[model samples]
Target: MLAAMRTFELSPADRFTFAQRAAVLSAAYADYFVPLWVNAQQMEAMDQIYDVDARRSVVAHAGREPIGMALLSLRGPRGWISAVGVIPAWRRRGAARAMLRRLLENAAQLGLDEVWLEVIEENAPAAALYRELGFSAARELLTWRYPADGDLLPIPRELLQPAPVERALAHFAAWHGQPPSWQREEPTLRHLAARSSAYELWMEDALAGYCVVGERPDAISILDIGLNPDFGPVKAGRTLLQALAHRFRGRAFTMINVPADDDLSRALAALRFTVTIRQWEMRLPIIAR
Candidate 1:
């Protein structure tokens, strides 16, 4: 059986064709909770933003044809299993398990102490797989979206002004109550700054909050937003969103991985940004080689 002869190998981005990896990912995620599609260009961008380590990632093959791929991102002693997918037709044949085992081994080889990944709250099979591999659920993360059709309520122009990216990040630690997810980490935001824009909210001439957004081909993303603890979260959040809406009129917006209990989450709800999905961050300790 072809399934019996399946194999897995490291396919560094430099040595592998991203087009092939992107095709497998698109096919593998066809039935995902949210629609996801990517081309090689986006893959390359992700490679840079996510800090993907080519040598540690894995590709699964069934008799020499690519069936799945997994990417690993390294940050000092930690590893992030950023993406994993096996094409639909080849699922249930141990491809995912084999690929993950290879990735864990790779992590061990690199002296990483832990590896992290996220699974949709409703994805039992994937969650079970992670648990079986010694992962533990960490925390809940929420995805929020606001449609572009609604009236853009006017914000006080003097209170909300365009900001340089560095200015927007000036109060990052004071603004967010919890550490951001891997994608929104300071380093990643800096990596994406070239393609993103920012806005700062002022209260009585004092900087109260700020937000960074990057326009995707489909919708604008609220990459990061933070409010000074001295200000009311809802008011600060509302002003930020209104300013953003006015600046990028007619573009829908999405914010991913906000902590479930975050004030930002509440602020988004108050403004009618519906929850699109919920996910659980998971982590596994890796035994060094």
Candidate 2:
């Protein structure tokens, strides 16, 4: 029988210091599908990249123990539910729902025009919950992986030139075929450039594309890549990926949350990259535009 009045309680995450909140999130996501194990330092870095607003986020407590957390990131009139997770023992106990409800309430109070989030396609329960909260899937995002030993495509490196990360981002919107995910947005890319390498492609004296790569302990991620449509996105993307493969040989590569309908996926497929995970980008409109 269920215990009477036994339920998770919501608290403003800002009540805790950054390090304490990071520890809470780390524990909550310890057994997640992707299994993130970020320390306070890493969490701080992520907060900067995601524009997280701790004051607008929430933590779920069972008694005095933080058993779950949900982060909210605000960018102008838009708010993103960056993450929502609960410890294994606390699953299906109303923690996630409580945290999410609190975040939505916070966003609405902040006068956000819309709120966004992504849910792994295979996680039916999470998807359903977001839908129940009035979120609608806007698009499908794909995570692509390339094996370390995969055959590298034959492409000339003559036109590929090393460049400042800012140079690449200067043309981001113009070169990209579709809108980017929040993680790949311009502000996030700028923050990530401190730890990444950037390069650009030139075709007939014109800038054809740009690519930025960020290395992890076990893999190299394509943090951002943009191909000018006028120059043939697939062709330009192939050259860019080939350059990345040659530059970082013997390292597995991952590119997360690329829109499924993006033209760049063709180049990825041609270069032996395969989809590893699919996610749905969902949004809840709070204020009419």
Candidate 3:
């Protein structure tokens, strides 16, 4: 009797062949509660922004057909895993494990001090896998959504002032406690500077909060929104978001990765924003020295 031979191959993703990547991501995330709303072009653009290197992907194949995929990116000493998925029919056949193990190995070889990724809150299997792979949860983030047409009261424009990039960056940095990974260093500065418009909120003639809007062709993404800790959560958060929505009235808006516990969550809910999804940030340290 001959031993059974496992049939699968793992290879780097080819940049020119994004159709494959899109197919896999779409299938794997089809049931996802809060979809990233990514398309082929968006995936390609993300690869460009992150600068896809050879160590960035592991694609599992049986014969010539792709069955699983994992994508990684280097952010300084941190390794960021963006999309990792195995086709439903291929699940539990070692595809996900193989790809993840390879990604971790690649991260170690690249001298990354830590690896991090986000998981949807309801994804128990994925969360278990991450924990089993030595990754730990760092924080919880919320995705809020609201109908484009909602009864929102108009906010006074005078309460909102344009925020200078420098001022916005400084305010974000000085936020109490640990800031989310996206708000750090280059990424934060880049996001703020790249925004179509940024604003500072004022209440009782004092600065209360700020927000930056990333305007897309069809919708506006609330990239970053924060309130001064001293301003008290209820008043500051409500004022800031109301002012933001007022600024973009008649436009579709969505916010990605807002902290679940933040006061903004409550305000948005009150304004009829639906809690679309919950995401968990995970990290793994790679460099010991």
* Top lDDT prediction, candidate number: 2
Return the candidate ranking by TM-score, descending. Answer: 2, 1, 3
Error of 1 at 43 (Å): 1.4
Per-residue lDDT of model 2, residues 1-289, tens digit only: 1223367788887776667777777877787777777777887887899999988889887676677889999899999999898877778878788889889899889999999999998889999999998999999999999998777667565456889999888888787878898998988899888888888887777888988988776689899998888889998888878877777778899999999988898889887799999999999999752
- In model 2, the runs with Cα more than 4 Å from the true position are 1-5, 157-159, 216-218
Model 1 spans with C-alpha error above 4 angstroms: 1-14, 151-159, 216-218, 287-289
TM-score of candidate 3 to 2 decimals: 0.80
Superior by lDDT: candidate 1 or candidate 2: 2
Q: Give RMSD to native, each candidate.
A: 2.6, 2.4, 4.2
Candidate 3 lDDT, 35-71, residue by residue in tens: 5446788678667555445346888776666677888
Compute the lDDT of residue 248 as modeled in candidate 3: 74
Tell me how far the alpha carbon of residue 41 in candidate 3 is from the true structure, in angstroms, after superposition. 3.0
- Ten consecutive residues with minimal summed lDDT in candidate 1? 6-15
Estimate, for each residue in 1-289, the C-alpha lDDT of model 1 and write its tens digit: 6456645444543456878778777878888887578999887888899999867788776655677888899889989999889877678888788888888988888889999999998899999999999999988999998887866667546445788898788778778888899998888888988888888878877888998988765579999998888888877887777777777778899999998988888888877889899999998988722
**Best of the candidates, TM-score:** 2
